[model samples]
Target: MAISFNQAFAGHDKMLEFRSERASVLANNIANADTPNYKARDISFDSMFNNEQSKLRLASDNDRHIQGNSTMGESSGLLYRNPSQPSLDGNTVDMQREQAEYAQNSMQFDTSFMFLDRKISGLKKALTGN
Candidate 1:
């Protein structure tokens, strides 16, 4: 059976999705920086990626592994709590830090999108012998 495009790029797609979600979380943190008692939220990409990889490795080791079901383990992607110095009002959201993180995440998101687009374009070319 031929692997579908989604299956082939499942890992990349999940990474992109997580990055996008993380960007949203950072943006929200920045937006709420002025709100009293607002805590900043940030995703731990290393932990998330490692967890996903472990899950995939475990799933692959199963005797009756299913193809499309491998991607179902991506639900562990979520923002982690920050342990940095908090504001006097108990707001952990630092506008400058959040803005920097948001900008970095945006760049990562765009890069991932571009990579996926290029991969898809390459696949199209291969399929069409262009």
Candidate 2:
């Protein structure tokens, strides 16, 4: 029987991708902090995860059928932010908040990376019998 990696990884890979995209969105907001009328955008994890999960899941015709695998499609979960302290320039990017979020997201990405790495290593050991 072929080893199905999707079950082994258990969505860490997907979470990693989501975190990376979120980082990009947050960085973009930071980059546009000075742009007039630029609305800061962010992605909701819940909505994005649901979107990806629905796409990744496949219908099982038989009780014991191998699942389908495919590239994860992009999601449109980006939403404009409502500023706590509105700026006169109509820019919604809050420097402090954006920085905080970016840092948090980086940490989460690192965590997911570590988990996936450990899982891969464990699988390798099992296969190698060493």
Candidate maximizing lDDT: 2
lDDT of each: 0.75, 0.89
State the local distance difference test value for candidate 1.
0.75
Regions of model 1 farther than 4 Å from truth: 50-84
Give lDDT tens digits, candidate 2, residues 6-112: 99998899889999999999999999999999999999888686667757768798978988765554557787888999999999899999999999999999999
Off by over 4 Å in 2: 53-75
Give candidate 2's error at residue 20 in angstroms.
0.5
Query: C-alpha displacement of 68 in model 1, angstroms?
Result: 21
- lDDT at residue 61 of model 2 (Cα atoms): 89
